[model samples]
Target: MLLADVVATSAALAATRSRKSKIAALAELLTRAGPGELPAVVAFLTGQPTQGRIGAGWRTLAELGAAPAGAPELTVAQVDAALGEVASASGSGSAQRRTVALRGLFARATQDEQRFLFRLLTGELRQGALEGVMVDAIATAAAVPGEVVRRAFMLSGRLPVTASAAVTGGERALGEFRLALGRPIRPMLASPAESLEEAIAEHASAIVEYKMDGARIQVHREGDEVHVYTRTLREITGSVGELVELVRALPCRSVVLDGETLALSDDGRPRPFQETMSRFGSTRDEQVRALLLRPYFFDCLHLDGEDLLDAPLRERNNALRTVAGAHLIPGESEPGAPAEILESALEAGHEGVMVKSLDSPYAAGRRGRAWLKVKPVHTLDLVVLAAEWGHGRRTGYLSNLHLGARDPDGGPPIMVGKTFKGLTDELLAWQTKTFPELETRRDDWTVYLRPELVVEIELDGAQVSTRYPGGVALRFARVVRYRPDKQAHDADTIDAVRATLKG
Candidate 1:
């Protein structure tokens, strides 16, 4: 299939506002693609690359002609040349030369085809569809259960591998497969629930655990060796060497754990989520060294040659505790007891609680009702210091709002954090219309909101920081609503913040 064809379909899908239309468009494309090409095609349609800085499309086309074994010598210049050729041609050439020749071949495409080609090559085909939707389409096209794709994704460590396996071996094969390392699995994530009681009622047999104010991380270990990856599956091994060392010291060897890694205070409390987020993709070894991180193991997907993902949550928690010892997140109990656990977790200074269905098997890349999160609604009076214009669908709105708490010693209201989440459409429209009037200055990207407006804000937690003027940062800070009744003088002070940090 031509790259332009895929890009055009992706663009059409992106333009459709209805999700079903987007899925239908993607399904049609999936039915037409070669089995081996489906993964790259799905990745392209979602505006994501399978691997490396280059498009998987280039690699997919090259493989069509059967490239030689061994890591083929590839360079930046070669990738550039191949991408350009693929843009214009029918993507046909000797396997060895296809990628390198794509650059020249791409130039032969028609104007509309060229536009699609550019989108494909740049991996910017931002259709509403994501990996989950593609998984469903692939399952439908391949005549396999969606769970087959999910299991294959978990065991094989890559969705494309799972897709290829499903295409070749059928659904039964995927259900029997096991996990291996250096491989990626579709990560499991949680969706917010209406309430903890509601979540418990929905998941009758769930394991309730503390939800820390931290960054999600997956750790891969082989004997004494360990590697850390972010939720995005980007390997950040070098940045968290201390945690890696800690993982290596665990009683069990050859373990792969799914958990959260966050900067911790001297007393072992998690730092604000933002501080932990900043550690991601960081280049400074000194900064990495200075930050004290604790790896809180919540679940064990794989350990000691057995795939624990299919085991009940209680079973998985047992295995986790045996292998991880103190690293295992405390409170592995039934959903019926979550309220008690929630109280304990809160008293321990955790953000709230994460409830997981006990009988739920790991669903890679799927946000099913298997896992849910509940948080305390903590509100504080804060000042708005700055705001940034939103992008994509939110382009015209002042979306990213910088927030600050009062400094009792008296200086500027120091920036604690910024957020675009938790804003309703009505609030977004109101901000769009009103923030301009409050702007102290305007730049192309941001408008500085006058600190005169005191707004009640809510957050997950506070942590020590080097970025903010107050030497603190907020976790998941969002505007609750304008505190019109409160003045700037009534805003919570840094002393109150310091007390929260100390507590």
Candidate 2:
């Protein structure tokens, strides 16, 4: 298939708001892809290249003065091969090699194809080809059930491979995927709940576990071999030696355990999140020993060669306890009063509790209501420094807000973070109208505003970050409402944001 066809499909997807329309367009595109080209085509449509993160940033791509080709002659396979060369260019003069490869690829692409390739390489493609939509499109194109494709993707952990399997052998090929050791599957995610009582009400008999403020890990052990993976399914077995050893010591011959790992203080309180993350970046023995990560396994997906992915939470937790005896996370099953569990989790210096239905099977990669996370909502009145232009459905409106915290010395509001989450259409309309009125200057993407509007923001907490002037950034921040009654000076200070970082 030509790259122009894929670019046109992406444009069509971005130009519409209907899910049905997007699926239909993607399905049609998929049906036209050859079996060998299906992987690259599916991956590119999902705003990623088959060779992930080819070290080509916007700066490098901008310097390439390659003029666009008058006509579209670049094939999907050709582009994929060029990107593979760029990704493999690593040694001394790798930067120049990558530039040469990228230039060669871009010279053959038309204007639209160049734009699509730029966005795809830079991770800025915002067309709504979400994984779920792509899965539906693959099923539609291959004449298979969506559930079958989704299950294959969950087990395989790669949409490209799943797409190829579906297009080639249909359901029979997809069914060959299973929970294999050393290969990481996508971790199950939980939806946020309004409150603990509300979550308990949603699940009559549920297991309430402490939601630890730590990194998510999935460990696989077979005999003496153990592999650890991050939530994104990236292998980190070598970097996390302690975790690998811990899992290897388990009595089970082979198992897949899902849980969190974090550094704890001497008093047994969880350390700040940055401290836990720092362990992943360093391999020095002293540094590793200084901040040892302790695993708290909560779910056992496979135990003793038996796959429990389709089992209920009750059976999985039982398997978790048998294998992860001392390492099991603290929780109460069928608690008489779940509010106490929330209070206990908070008191333990952790995030709130995760309420899970006992009868619900482990739905990997899906954020359904089977598990709900109930945490205390932290709200701050922050000043809006700027607003960026929206994309796709949010086009023609001011979207992503630049949040700033008050500087007590009155120098200026310190930029803490930016967020486009939790914005309703009404809020977007209000912002589009109100922001320009307060605009001090305008740029291509963002409009700088006079620090007059104070917006109430809800967040999980704040974490140490070097990216912002405040030395701290909000985590999971979303708009609660506009605090028009409050002044910019009344907004939360940098100290207040820093204090939210747990010890």
TM-score of each: 0.65, 0.78
Show model 1 residue runs off by greater than 4 Å: 15-24, 35-39, 49-52, 55-81, 84-106, 121-123, 172-177, 285-287, 332-337, 378-503
Weakest lDDT window of 10 consecutive positions for candidate 1: 67-76
Backbone Cα, N, C clashes tallied per candidate: 17, 0
Query: 165-223 in candidate 2: lDDT tens per residue?
Result: 99899999999999998899977878667678888889767999999878888999999
Per TM-score, the best of the predicted structures is 2
What does the lDDT come to for candidate 2? Answer: 0.85
Model 1, residue 328: what's the lDDT?
79
What Cα-based lDDT does every candidate model obtain? 0.67, 0.85
lDDT string, candidate 1, 183-281, tens digits: 555477676565788888887677788887676788878887787877666688887778888988888767878887778777866665546755665
